[model samples]
Target: MQTDKVLLEILNNRFSAIVNEMGYIVYRTGFTVFVKETQDYGVGLVAPTGELFAYPQEVGVANMLGMPMEDAIATIPEYRPGDVIITNDPYTTGGMCTHLPDIHLYKPFFYKGELICFLWDFIHSSDVGGLVPGSIAPSAYDIYQEGLIIPPRKLYREGKLDQELLDMILANCRIPEQNWGDLKALLAALNTGERRLTEVIERYGVETVKQGITDLLAYGEQSARAIIADIPDGTYTFSDYVEGDVTTQIPLRIKLALTVQGSDMYLDFTGTDPQIRAAFNVPTFGKTHHWLTVGLVTFLRTKNPSIPLNKGILRPVHTTVPSGTLLNPVPPASCGIRYATAIRVIDVTFGALSQAIDDVVPAAGAGQVAIVLISMPDYQSGGYKVSVLQPMQGGSGGRPVKDGIDGGDFSAGFLRNIPTEMLEADIPILVHKYMFPDDTLPAGQFRGGLGVDFRFQVFTPHCIVTARGMERHRFRPWGRKGGSAGTRALTKVNPGTEQEQNIGIIDILKLEPYDLVQIMTPCGGGYGDPLDRDPDKVLKDVEDEFITREAAESEYGVVIRNGRVDQAQTEALRHRLQTSRILKPFDYGSEREEYEWLWPPEVQD
Candidate 1:
């Protein structure tokens, strides 16, 4: 190795620090709720070839660590000193920009007329010109309907802001001023990265720092390979489903086969459904793209705590995703809800890995991250004004030794909660119920985490509500080791009222003044048998109002009186429950049991 190990470690920390500083600039200065609150943004330093060489460790969207930048960079063959490029076209950039609302911008960093690296980041704008507010609709049929597409172009040339380009971009958006504010935030982060990297170069000398980058990438590959080598070499298979997209009642399947031979792994996505007409098709370009293999990145990071966060981590990983499938769709296929598929992709990745090492993996989480947004008429500007309400996420899956998280899952766990002020800040949506549901006594010995039951009333004359990425309605998360399945998701209008109506998966619903809407996200899967759970813990749950007294007795076989335990009754009920019937290792609710009964996993394979 050209660089010493200690020096490489030092460089890794320095690069990560620069990215962290950049991330902070975005969060603090960002304009919309999704940015400052939902944290649907990312910042990092990329190699000249467009792959991330150094990224933030614990800030912003972590799954984007493997985002490919080669195609995006190649579009602009030549770059002047102080040049910055921008794009939101998922197809042209090879999925670097997964959706249109996520505007990706990058600035080239040059050292003595030599290209050192690129400072890159993206922000999910509140609205871009589209079929609805927030530039996303689960029922949208084509990419064009989702939002404005900014093909790879120079937003800044030689540090000169392209005012014309900026004007054209804002022209199509529903809320131009707010999106402009976000663009300015992205620009601020890039400037911060430039100054920081310049300081790094001054301290370490350009040649040495350059050598360190090469060595750091190599170290990342070595560390990642070591993580793979630790897992037992074998072939494992697991499959999961994405319940009914906007077009069909048929659930889309995501099948994975993990072939582990020595320090290399090959993932084959065969027997999966073809691209749908809806907005959830993943645009991975048939490669081991970021969204395709991000679950492994999570697994790898956990396995080797100090592995360098860079593109090199994917060095030992390979994939074969068939073109025109859910994972690798052709251009113009609606992909605004691709994260819905990404959530399932991550689940199936662990599903296959669990077969390899059942004891290490947790049961599945809620399996859905539904984002709620509203668009109302802007009377002042004679345009529509869009605002984010909240990102509704169910709890994480139950681990071998612990219960699932209450209201946040591992898939989108890093995102911060939307402040109450933000939810009612720009819009007239009053928060009615934004708390977790009363427990229905979850499935496992280590029970799944609870989910939210959000209800809001709109005060505007007329409004359009869009809740994309909704899932787990028909098929809830499955449990492991005799655990029961997690509860299903549901959406309602004026719930429990004379005008009550069930609106499971929505494109965009028109709401009148004083109209109420209710949404409940699915919960995480359980790890083990409910009978195996501690009785005292069940009693504690009842005391906390997490579960009803009836649920305690029926689900957990626990008898309580006057907020305390009834030992004798509990013992008899538990004994009766134990003798009832044998339970399967995986309990996939009655719905999925019926689903598999008719079609079967064998035929899907």
Candidate 2:
């Protein structure tokens, strides 16, 4: 038996509202810009079983939807009313606390001396004692290089702060004060969640709220399956890549064989390449991890926008995450840049899904997030300062009926762009051209989103810049139907000058004073054929400066004369272009096409 359908929805919204409030509290009270500006944090309510019953949907990072908390919660079996657990060790917490930079914490909620639930939260705190500034380096060879690993332990005990534990953690960070500030903000947010949840428990009665948790989870499972069952039941397979590691040209390949049978979907990654020494490992603990199942989540959410966001959504999804693969790496493997591999996993997962439901799926979005990080020495205090210069993101892929969002990628749509004034106030840099390039992919019916145009000049000497998640350079985002691929990411130093140098996908760049770096992120891939695009839409793009007049004529087969459509010329151009070549449903650009021709997916193990 279950609670009334209407009552369950009311309870769901109540729980969701609490977590969203928790997230907003953190954002308002946080000391770090990563929390205040980018909203790179997560908070949720967890049942005693450790599965998240409620998660913040409107605020914070939505990537941890399916993150398993059973292992992390089991560490400290006996928890008092005010006791809390803190961890950032991926290995120790069964990948629950993925990566060291993401400092995670959870506090038990008690009602009438009985533990009712737990409120969990995490912030992507900058500089957790790593070899690099932001504690993330794609070139990182091992976990030790990433940062300090705090196993699941008591951050607070018996309503008391563990000063020793706190000291040990803050001692290892580059910006200890800022991290402590963020920790306080998390604590404040958790308190907010506890208070809100307590009010609901008080109003609805403890038993009802407790049962509501169980009922809501089942409801979530049902809702997700309802959406997923709509997807055609079949086996679809696809593979994609992360450019390469620091030392090797062999790219990190993520493969997926998606099998949809009724309401359930099984993701088999048996043939994925072995994990590398770099920080690209996903560390999923050889199960269906949240990081691995993001593509399926996107599908469910996109297909059924009203589907509840909770652990129940994962009930209908399972995975065969083979050990030693990029998705499930062994211990000591560098997993700091695990998100890089996960994004590619999302791509392959979508790749397989597109074969099943082509019209429902959009073309690829900006498959990367290049967050500009800077670590410099403070001249006044003679201390070190680490800060995020900006999070430059690519655009989302063009959809069937709508254009992709400019400067917003599906992977990072939740995160907000940091203001130029704020970044300059903290760092010795002048941000210029922090806007969208007035151009888009000539997708068939709609244009793909225009990615960010982030350019800045560093004024402080020997300032280290680490732009992690810089991808889509070699292989661009693939277009669906007859649409063309999006543009590739480009990094140029002193453009249009004698000192111009188009430096490709960077790792950690060191700059002298007054060094200007311009990073133009890749746009999303388009859907359908360019020639099939509405001419008025093409002209609007021209008037809006989204595409050049010459490009409108050349790419979209839309010729214009004196601001009006050249009907005769347009017809002839479209005809010539249409009959020129047989269009492939997917346009993966030249690099992907050439590489696949040499090493095909069908032939691979």
Candidate 3:
């Protein structure tokens, strides 16, 4: 064992740098805008045991830190120096690749006939053949409708590309040329990893490099356990719900009972609702999946960001997602939009942890990643021109110390929005308006973040629009302490015109030329009492147009007059509001309260 801490640290940094460099290579060389612009990809260095030993933190997908590759690797018969395995089937890959659109590739690195490590990378391809143009639809009832499911198989053999396999895979996709280019980019990244790992092995002996990997994992485990030990030992239970499944109007509940004891913790999702017929199922494979425990990893990162992000962080925590539930669904259940339910898992985790340590966790966030895709006839080209207009998301929750980030959702922080110029240039669309709405945020001592209001017009005729992962339209994001719940989402068509129409929670919409589409995202929940907010902060918010004068006075209990704070009136109003307020652990807004009244938690379970 390598007991030298300095040597291990040096090896760790070197290995991390290799993967980080590989990620940048993919980003720069990728052909599609999805990879180059949004960066919906991940790169990591995996051990022979299939656990991630070193992962890139600066680039690539942030939530794929603890993804295990054992199940996918074991399916292969043998491994050679230049052989690679490719898969995107969630069940066959053991949840390593959650959806089919994300193409995962793995290549083994050999050091003098001995296996050193495996290079792993995945990119969200722009289009895979399916019912919808984007290969994802909220109404999809089975996996077949999502896209093509590729099982673990050899994509390359003995440094040679499998032409037959490559051709077949590309033929099934809608955009064959683009998919082939992105696959090559992934191969380039894997090649970079191989060269870098070989150089490291040459400098330090293979044995020393292997020992350093073990030591780094141990260090991460130790750090994670130490942080977990700080929380008081207890079991905390919390429950939250998705507004509705795709096929049904009834809300689906996700329940969690988090048990923390000493340096170990266990999360049980036994009481969760059954899997829906829609595409909201999460394929966890009944293990400690990354999506089930990402909140803990995020919490640890917030406490000590210096810790290397790898699978070791998951050692101290365990998860139990019951079969037939939304988190762990059986085969044939569609998981096209699993990210929507994954965000709720994060919220429920935060809700449970807050009961154990109130000050550490934040309130509920706008828990959805609304993806808007537009497909129109391409007159220049023979086929249709399909492109993603925007992957719109809401804001983060308010913290005890500071206000939540405005117009920034934590769920898809890594996926950036396409630039306006690029969208207009590539597609027949015009961005009429894109800005935060005034007074839409929930009020508190540290108010919730503001949400976005986006309006655009289609310049092309016979355009079809599809929006997936829409939430917070009915039940709002709940607040904590005396803070208020955030606003809900809304969608409209041709607003301010005589032909204006309201489309509430739509799966797809057909449009003609000059048809306007407006999408309003939800905000995060606030933390602490609204009356405790500073008057100056309220005045500044009013001036910035994030909040109106009426909301500053009514919701926050802060009085503003002549563009300034009325200190005496504010103090009196705050005192009165504080006296009348009834504090609750959670404030789920009136909409949820009304729904819960009819269908209580106990009855649902």
Which digits, one per residue and each the tens of the lDDT, describe model 3 over residues 1-605?
Answer: 45598888889899999999999998998877778777888899998877898988888778887686788888887899899888899998788878788899999888888888799999988778788877888788999998888998899998998999998898887778888888889999999889998899889888999888887888888889988899889999998887636578777889999999999999999899898888888898877787887787788888788887678878888888889899999888888888888889888999999998887788988887787888888787667787777778887788889998888766677778888888888787999988888767688888888788999999788898887778888888889987889889989999989999988665768998999999998999999888888889988989998888998988888898898899999999988987886877799999889988998888887
Candidate of highest lDDT: 1
Q: CA shift at 33, candidate 2, in angstroms? A: 0.8
Candidate 2: tens digits of C-alpha lDDT, residues 379-404: 88777888987777898888888887
Q: With candidate 3 superimposed using the best TM-score fit, by how many Å does residue 344's alpha carbon deviate from the native?
A: 0.5
**Candidate rank order under TM-score:** 3, 2, 1
User: Candidate 1 on 81-133: residue-level lDDT in tens?
Assistant: 87889889999998798888899899999988999988999998888889888
All candidates: TM-score: 0.97, 0.97, 0.98
lDDT for model 1, on a 0 to 1 scale? 0.86
Candidate lDDT scores, in order, read 0.86, 0.86, 0.85
Candidate 3 lDDT score at position 267? 94
Poorest stretch of ten by lDDT in candidate 1 = 438-447
Residue 358 miss distance in model 2 (angstroms) = 1.9
The C-alpha local distance difference test score for the whole of candidate 3 amounts to 0.85
User: Residue 566 error for model 3, in Å?
Assistant: 1.7
Supply candidate 1's per-residue lDDT for 411: 86
